[model samples]
Target: MKTSRLSTALLIAYGIAILGFLYLPLVSVGLASISKARYLSFPIRKYAFGWYEDALTSDTVRDLLVISLKVAGVVTVASMVIGFFGALAFARYNWRFRKTYQKLILLPIFFPQTVLGLALLMWFNALGVVPSWKTAIIAHLVWIAPIATLVVSIRAFSFDAALEEAARDMGANQWQTLREVTIPLLMPGVTSAGLFAFLLSWGNFPLSLFSTGADSTLPEWLFAKMVSGYSPLVPTVGMLTVATSAVLVFGGLILAWAIRRLRPES
Candidate 1:
């Protein structure tokens, strides 16, 4: 009992310490954004919403946000489509060099984003392609697709092959079996994979920095401000991003749960 109690105490302490280490900067930024002082200070003297107003109204921020959304949407769709096909190939097919193809697909997930960004940028420049939202979307797809593929493949492994086999035996064509039987069963996995892709693309920085255009994506815009100097406005943007992400991801999880609950039990 004493050993268990000690372990519990240590775990609690570690968790609290970790949270503090991670969130202290965010807390400071939140405080600074509302502080009346020109510079950040401990024990904020006064508070105001002026920084949030400035952040919301800034033309630069607005444009960056639109770019971020466009890139994220494109990345999510492309990643999901490529991932679905890859998952089907991996989960449902067998062939020589299968392991080699699997490794190639997953290689980007383990690669350093900085190296990936530089390599992609150089490749695009060599090809005479301009850095734009399209470039950002395509670059992010390379990294995010692997994770999406893995998610769907894991789901596929748990899947009942009986359904597809039954459809085939019932004279369903290959396309019909895939479109009507396989995909419906994989909806949960696909939705989760798309969400993951969206979040990654929305927050990715190094790749965005290299691939973004004159408009700039949200992360690149934020990075520019941070590189130039720290300001209260920065935290306001951070808070907004955090809040938006939380709402979206949480809402999605809830919706998925509700759908499962509403399904007819066999």
Candidate 2:
């Protein structure tokens, strides 16, 4: 009993340590955001919210938010659709070149994002395509779609094929079986995949760095500001971005909970 209690105490301590490690930087950024001084210093002497207000009213900040939202929203939708079919193919259907196809689809995930972004940039140049938010979508898709597929594939692998077969046996056609049986079963995974895709795309920097030539997303704008000079608005905007992501994530969780509650018990 003593050993078990000691182990539990250690585990709790470890978990707290992990959470602190992960969120301490965010806490620092939050502090910097509220600092009233032109230069940031720890154990802040004065605090103010004016920088956040400045960020809110800045035209550049608004443009960055819009572009980031557009990119993330489109990527989320496309990732969900592509991931649904891809996960089915990956974990359900077995066909010729299945291994090869899986490897090819996932290859991009293994590549360094910086190198991948540069290669994508060169490819666009070769094709005489201009780099823009539209191209950034393609770049993000290359990296994010595979991750979405992997996410959904976890749920797909656990799916009971017998349920699908049972639907077919009950006089359902291919489309009907998919609609009534497969899709409903897979919806949870698809939703989770979309959440991952949106978050990843929203925070993506490397790929967006290369692909969004003239148009800048929030991260890109933040990077430019950081490199050029320190702006108090940087941390303010950072906190705002973090807040937006947190809201979306919490909203998704609440939505999922509501869905589970509303769903009829089988």
Candidate 3:
């Protein structure tokens, strides 16, 4: 009993240490953002919202943030549409080379993102497409769609075909039955997938670096700023991005929970 208790205590301590290691930098940045300092340093004395005010007011930062939001929005929608169909097909059908098809769809996730980005750049150039905001959207979609499909597939594969059959038996056409039955059941996974796609798009730097052209997302903008010089506003911007991401992630969790709660027990 003593040995077990000691082992559990050690495990708890290890977990706390890992959490602190991961989050300490982010926590420090958050504190620095609120500090009334023109330069970041230890021992934050006075706290204010001035840095946040500057972040919001800066035209370049504002434009980059807008770009991030727009790109993320497009990626989220596109991922959902692609994921929905891919999940449906993968879950509801069986065919020759099914496993091969699954591997093909999920290839991007396993590939190194930098290589994927570089390959895409070449592919786009070969196709006579200019790298721009549109190209960034395409690049992000390539990386994130598979993730969305995987997330949605988790719920879809668990779905009983009986429910779909009942709908069909009641004189429902394929489209109507799918719209009324399949979609409702898969909404939780769909919502989570959208959130994943959005967050990944918003934070993606390596992929965006190759395809963003002159239209940079916020993470790209942040990287440029950090590399160029020292500015307290850098930490502030980082803090804002971290906080926004945290909120959206948690909100997505709550939404997923609510969706499950509202869904009828099967």
Candidate 4:
């Protein structure tokens, strides 16, 4: 009994340590956001919220937010759609060159983002395509869609083929079986993939760095500001971005809960 208690205590300590390791930096940034001094330092002498207000009211910040949102939103939707099909092909279908196709689809995910971004910039230039927020979406999709596919494929592999067969035997056509049986079963994975895609795209700096030529996302702007000149608003904006991601994560959880609740009733 004493051994079990000790084990449980150790596990709790380990869990707390892990959480602190993950979030301590963000906590420090949060503290800095409220620091009133122009230069940030630990054990802050003064505290104020004016930096957050300045960030919230800044036109540049607003533009960056809008660009980031647009890129993430588009990446989320596209990743879901592509992931759905890719997962089906990856795990459900057995066809010629399936292994090769899988490797090709996931190749971009393995490439260094900086190199990938640079290569993409050259490709865009060679094609006479202008780099912009639109290009950023394409770049993000190249990296994120494969990750989304991998997420959905985990769920897909466990799916019972018998259910699809049974639906077909029930006189349901391909589309109907896909809609009524396959999609509903796979929705959980798809939703999780979307959340991952959005968060990854929103926080991405390397891909957006080269791809968003004239335009800038929040992460890109933050990088530029951090390098060019120090601003008190840096931590403030960082906190805001962190807050937005947390809200989305919580919102996704609530949505998933609602779906689960509604499923049995329906």
After superposition on all CA atoms, what RMSD does each candidate show versus the true structure? 2.2, 1.7, 2.3, 1.5
* Candidate 2: tens digits of C-alpha lDDT, residues 1-266: 35788899999999999999999998999999999988778889999999988999999899999999999999999999999999999999989988998899889999999999999999999999999999999999999999999999999999999999999999999999999999999999999999999999999999999999999999998899888878889999999999999999999999989999989973
Runs in model 2 with CA error above 4 Å? 1-11
- lDDT of each residue in 33-147, candidate 3, tens digit only: 8888877788998898888899899997888888888899999999998998889877767788778889899889988999999999999999999898889999999999999
* Lowest lDDT block of 10, candidate 4: 1-10
Q: For candidate 4, lDDT tens digit of each residue in 85-151? A: 9999999999998999889988998899999999999999999999999999999999999999999
**What total of clashing residue pairs does each candidate reach?**
0, 0, 0, 0
Ten-residue segment with the worst summed lDDT in candidate 3? 257-266
Pairs of residues clashing in candidate 3? none
TM-score of each: 0.91, 0.95, 0.91, 0.95
**Model 4 misses residue 42 by how many Å?**
2.1
**Residue-level error in angstroms, candidate 3, position 246:** 1.7
lDDT of each: 0.85, 0.95, 0.89, 0.95
Candidate 2 achieves a global lDDT of: 0.95
Assess candidate 4 and give its TM-score to the true structure: 0.95
Q: State the local distance difference test value for candidate 3.
A: 0.89
